[model samples]
Target: MSTYDFAVIGAGISGASVAFELQAEARVVLIEAESQPGYHSTGRSAALYTPNFGPPIVRRVNAVGRAFFEAPPDGFAEAPLLSPRGALTLFKSGNEGELAAFLTNGTERDPIHPIPVAEALRLAPLIRPEMVAAAAFEPGVTDMDVAAIHQGFLRGFRRRGGDIRRAQPVTALRRDGATWRVTAGGEEISVATVVNAAGAWGDAVARLAGARPVGLVPKRRTALVIDGPADLDLHGMPLVEFAGDAPYLKPDGGRVMASLADETPVEPQDIQPDDLDVATLVEWLETHTKTSVRKAPRTWAGLRSFVADANPVVGFDPELTGFFWLIGQGGYGIMMAPTLARIAAALATGGNVPADAAAAGVNAADLSPTRFRF
Candidate 1:
């Protein structure tokens, strides 16, 4: 059997980033089930980087990752990873309480401030003036070039002698004394450590390794793309989101991408957009904004896996030696990739948490898989 220092399952963004970070210091092999990497969640991301998006722990990771996205390492990418694209969260007249709570919770860490209705309309001309009572703006939000970043990691990993095996779905993982014997696509691989970056299939991978499941629930989120007017210029239009679990619209290449932000729980597998979700998104857009949507040219769905507490599961498994958990990123995987990859590399190589992570107030224990044990 071919042997390596580490075997990372799933060549999605999480696995790619971790493998890229570890390749220089250790012999790393990235295994993917699909014919191509990022066939699922990573490739279907909305590709927005808003610091105030997820839970507090997620926000902390995003904070640390921002520096890297702002200025990637030397020779990491051919073009910039992030470009400024502001975000506006609007509240209807009756939903003022929710708006207040959002501002109260987000203003401290995020660059979120109250914006007048006129200014909010100026930022996004598609919004209906009478529908909005109050709005908050985050000027630091940016449009992330996810493809470029993922490619950068893959290129760097290959350059550093990392091996990537596509079309190999891991079926079994057996412990052989101090190492792991992994069976995938009719091939066996021996590795000193195993990193479960399998995204939606994280629980299954852990089970294969004789490790306990962390209760990862994969939720389906759907998005639809609609055509825009030929003369309409979408430049400088901020991503517009309504208050109180409403639909959001983001500019996409002179078109608009709309979503209801649904988090419907589903089994781990390839997912498709529901007809009702598309209808709901269209209804919301018609009711809250001036944008018209007759039909969607394309609609798709992706799974955002999350544990019970909704924080990412990182660090080594408590009961399994040399088996690491790098799952439960939810919808923030791309935005938090750099910091999470750094943490995974540090833990796998017997090193401390990276100084940048600590400086950004990221406590490894908070993201550890051990928290779910008790």
Candidate 2:
């Protein structure tokens, strides 16, 4: 039987990043159910990196990961990982209080300033002039190349002698004394530890290993692409989001990528966009802006799994020996990948959290699986 120091399940961004981080120090094996890596959430992400997004814990991770995106390591990628693209959060009349609250909370750690309606319109002319009463601009937001980031990790892992097994869905897990026996694709492998980075199937994976479930719930979000005028020129526009939990629209290759921002609970599987959700997105777009959606648009959906507190769960399982969890990233997985990967690798290897993570105010205890032990 083949043996490794660690076995990481799932080959999405989360799994790939953690495997890459651990490969240099440990003999690691990455196991994926799909035929290719990043066939799910990672591939269908919005691919945006906003430092001020998500909850407090997520924000801290995002902040820690920013340095890596700004200046990647030598030969990490042929092209830049991030491209400049600002973000604007708009509010309509009678929603000033909500907008103020958003601005206050958003600017606490980042420099998201309030912009006048004219400036917001100048940044994104698609907004209906009469509908927008207030706007907050985050100038540091950028478009992330999701594929490049995932590939970079895979490359580094492969270069460090890490093994990756695709089309091998983990069917069973058995704890045998000091090692774990993992069954996938009718083959078995032994490892000293198992890291569950299965995203939406995190809880299911734990159950298969006879470990307690962490109450992970997957939620589906739909997005669509619409046609834009050839002469419109929206390459320099900021990502536009309506206030009070409304839909958002972003520039996508001269077209518009719109979403109703719907979060419907779902089972873990390959997801498809609902017709009603797409219609809702189009209706919201047409009602809020001068843009017209007269034809059917390209649409898709992805799953974002979350726990009760909406923060990530990382570290060793409280009750199961040699089982580490690196799940519950929610919608901020891409932005938080670097820091979370570092944290997971350190914790799984019995090492302390990175200094940069501590410097960014990341409380290792807060993200540990122990928090959900009770």
Give the alpha-carbon lDDT of every model: 0.89, 0.89
For 180-221, candidate 1 gives per-residue lDDT tens digits of 999999999999999999999999999999999999999999
Worst 10 residues of 1 by lDDT: 102-111
**Overall local distance difference test of candidate 2:** 0.89
Give the residue spans of candidate 2 off by over 4 A. Answer: none
TM-score, candidate 1, is 0.96
Candidate that scores best on TM-score: 2
Mark the regions of model 1 whose C-alpha exceeds 4 Å error after superposition.
97-99, 107-109
What lDDT does model 1 reach?
0.89
lDDT of 2 by residue, 1-374 (tens): 89999999999999999999999899999999999888888988889998887888898889889889888878779999999988999888988668667876565556788888899998898778888888889888899999999999999889999999999999999999999999988999999999999999999999999989889999999999988665577878888887776588889988898877788999999999998998888888888877788788999999999999999999999899999999998999998998899999998999888998988788779898898877
Question: Any residue pairs clashing in model 1, and if so which?
Answer: none
